[model samples]
Target: MTDVSKIFAPGGVLSQTIDGFQPRPAQQQMASAIAAMNDDAGVLVVEAETGTGKTFAYLAPALLAKTDDGERKKVIVSTGTKNLQEQLFHRDLPRIRDALAPDAIVALLKGRSNYLCIQRMDQFISQPIKHDPAVALQLQQQSRVVKYWANQTRSGDLGELTELAEDAIILPQITSTADNCLGRDCPAYADCYLVKARQEALEADVVVVNHHLFFADAVLKDTGFGELIPHADLVIFDEAHQVPDIASQYFSESISTRQLQDLAQDMRLLYGTELKDLRQLSTVADQLDKCGRDLRLQFARDPERGNWREQMRRAQVIEDSERLADTLDRAQAIAKAALGRNKVLDQCYERLVLLKARWQQLTNTQRSGYSFWYETTPRQLSVHQTPLSVAEKFTSYMLAQQMQWVFTSATLAVNGSFKHFTDRLGLGSAQTLVLPSPFDFAKQAMLFLPRYLPAASDPTMAASFAAIAKQLIAHNHGGTFLLFTSYRMLNQVAAILQEQESSDRLILVQGRTSKRELLDQFVDAGDAILLGTSSFWEGVDVRGDALRLVMIDKLPFAAPDDPLLQARIEDCRLRGQNPFQDVQIPQAVISLKQGAGRLIRDALDTGVLVVCDNRLVQKEYGQTFLASLPAMSRTRDIAQVTEFLSKD
Candidate 1:
């Protein structure tokens, strides 16, 4: 018998480690499949439902894979978020190793920015105030706190500074970036914290990373950190549904007005003593800043949400963008003439050169298989050139690396088809497995489709959603997540709930506070209604009766105006396909699956999933969305839903 079956048997290690652990057939099956995978099998795509113990199911077999000489095989376990990476590294992996593989070594690696650069921090502290003394004074105060921690910390991770909050202005100045890092030439190269972390990852038996970092290393080649994929024997992706979007973002070319301004500011600071030519350089910086401001205003004239590709072709827009690029080129020449062999100045000059290159790329008409667009943020404007499709390149990358892959997530399939996901990654021929959750969903949960509501796009839909949500909260006595697709809807529904004459129930809305604070309030209130949007849709877990209902305001579809989505839609149309059915509907189906999964976390947990959009029941594709959900009891009867919630 295999080690997998022996360890997963009735009286095995897991049962002993976890209290009252029942042997799950689904878990055992998944472990066996993972144990059986070889290089010849290529990739394995597994859709393990919510309660299937997926983390352990894969981790157990991965831990057991070893050479006959008893050397541990190197493995990379990549998750979709840093929270899960922390959980796996600090919590789950240790417990599993203690119970199973006692000698195993595991390391958690995050992006370079997550760690403090001792060199950068020291330089920041020693430098005289050149710009903004108020900001300088704040950094000086914070550096004292950081200095003490830097001496005591082995990891140099910023996460250890509990007193410092995430939004602290002091962080960006102290952290290292690829553009700013001097690499081997830095004075503190021997003691660099980020270099030490990478060394540890290189030697560890198992490495934990988030998807963003993994994709960066896999494709972007120059993510500052060296290659990780070529060194791994196997790569496992948890929450694999998020890979396509992250890949799209990492592979694209982006340059922003903020980036240009930062380069200019850094150039100003890199020079130590004031040169006689300082006034000339300062004037050039100011002119470039004005040009950036003008470019921002030009983009803001059209507030339409999506790609501004056509707008970029406008004669005035083209002239202005070229002028902005020219101003920067002139500024670069002035700086090169003023500054000597200073390393800091060299790095800043390189950034200026790169920015110019991106501008040339953005405005050039020769590039095919790419979408050129511009977007505006509250503080700045940006330009992007994204590939119309990354499928071919991604597939070639995976094959070139020659590492066997395992991709698992609860939300990978739509209407029992894996084509939506597989095609996106160009893995149509990979081995596939669908393991349903062992939870008795028919008894443990119910799908409630509220009938006869306003269209999801209607302005008054928020009021109707609030009315239904209010009734459900009254019936269930709280622990509800009122999820909206848009911030406008979220705010409107929140206001309506506030104005309604109902019994006092704690209501926590997103953006009112930090996400951590909101979740803490929700869990502590125990009977509170949490109003949120996209970020709250997934990666949230509230087990048992504390989260008894998940009320989604509409079908979770990507906005038609999103630049990336629009590009994908046009690509599909040009190929003579139904973009709505093949692309849009499948994508939304997967999102709905993720949102509905917040409930029924454990075998005994129960709840009701309420989708307020009547289109889910009226549209022809409604059944496609409905079929992708767990096989739970379904109904439109309000009384039935009320009774289910009212149960003890």
Candidate 2:
């Protein structure tokens, strides 16, 4: 019972229960550590590399832990992505439960938006949308699908509707957001799917969620309204490297053109049905729409995105935003006077209130440790203010909750140091552990650095990169992932390769198809080269020879001109810290590690990692990136790389 082998041994429950389950030393080590942890262990950061069976490492201990009453202790498992969350909830948890904790109850809790709101769907069905015929048609078709799922689905999660695209236009119409939910006042409150799901999560011994939902709930709890945090004694964060970024996003204030337009459109619907002669409100709503357009036109002149803090203080931007806020305030006054008692009108007014509040928060930037920025798309404009440091806030929030925290990821540490991750989360004194993947990288993998390729910043780099990719694909006969840092470079290199490569070899590029679809195609084709950007860098697992070669265009460094990156650099500079070393370098190292990890996923899996960036070998900081990766066989000779690929 003291060792994990009692459960993971050859004749143990796990081996007996799961098919082809060969236990690894890393998994046993991690499980032992987690089982030994108690509430007094402030937080634990574990860097379990690929193939470490990290999910079971945490889940096994969580399921095995019990209360005095013999009931399993509640554990909340939060992942960085919905895919991982679904896998944990639908696939992995069942196996673990059947083997160790059959009595353990499990529930999957997504955000409110993931559940269909019967009330909202009904309202949308009843409303006359005179705008786009295509949209109306899509809504009509998707509504029937939603209705069918509504009848059959116990969870009522939108994820169950696999036929619909993730970004389907009908989703928002049938789904409820925090701002739009009628709560207990809704007619369908009794059978509300979102509420029912939350109740299930509350009752379950284990709950699976994503980082966004976890932080949203944490923020809500800070405001005294969150429901799930109080019930769980242990919280496990998978893919925990994404926490700092996701936390910063949720903690910030943001107002977008779409929010304004949605509020206006909702007001129009309510005005037409519930109130009349509110011409002033209609005019103000029209003004709000115009203001949004004006702001986009004004900002879109420069780059598609930028930090508008200085420009936000300028006369034009400030005046326009104030005018938009004022219009909403006037609409609120008008709604109260005319459509005071109407429920639909009340909901519209509530949305307006939130819109106004968000606008105020975005414009008012007198507080310290906050950076303001704006992004402009062809159809939308947004203003955001994020804190320079979410570490203090995150640490306080976790400490106040008093739960045993576990943060595990394959990419948390850089150069064998957890300081970058810990400092970012203000968990400086927390316990940290690194469990390297049991896979023998040196024996199974090769790190190929081409000596003849152009520098990363050179104009001919794309052509050189494509040539290298073609050679690798030719040698390996597919199972290659050509990952780029940007879409522009991805498209450029992809086009170059497409023109030069044989027509028989399947080439799948991102953005041309859905990620799931692309992965399926890649696996089915077996000999296909996938050219993708940031999304394919991590959380993409293709065990066996289906994915063997991973080529990164350059170190995954954020664009210097990026608003958030720029702000972080400035923040570091202000603190008298070297931004390149303290911020950019560490971040890139983590990202590079994630990209490289895409190659060797399992013990038997073997591949070559080719970083096209000469800087990875030539720069002074290159050693840091090299040290951060698994100790694979390094080579500069093309002959060695081709020979290694020729083998298993």
Alpha carbon lDDT of each predicted model: 0.82, 0.83
lDDT score, candidate 2, position 457:
82
Each candidate's TM vs. the true structure?
0.94, 0.95
Candidate 2 lDDT tens digits, 308-378: 66777778888887888788788878777765577766777777777788788877777667888888776
Model 1 scores what on Cα lDDT? 0.82
Off by over 4 Å in 2: 1-5, 68-70, 221-230, 277-279, 301-303, 338-340
Score residue 545 of candidate 1 by CA lDDT. Answer: 76
In model 1, the runs with Cα more than 4 Å from the true position are 67-70, 128-141, 223-225, 228-230, 274-287, 301-305, 331-340
Pairs of residues at least 3 apart in sequence or in different chains that clash in candidate 1: none
For candidate 1, lDDT tens digit of each residue in 329-399?
99778767756667666666677788788788888845667877778876588878888777888898887
Give the Cα-based TM-score of candidate 1 against the true structure: 0.94
lDDT of 2: 0.83
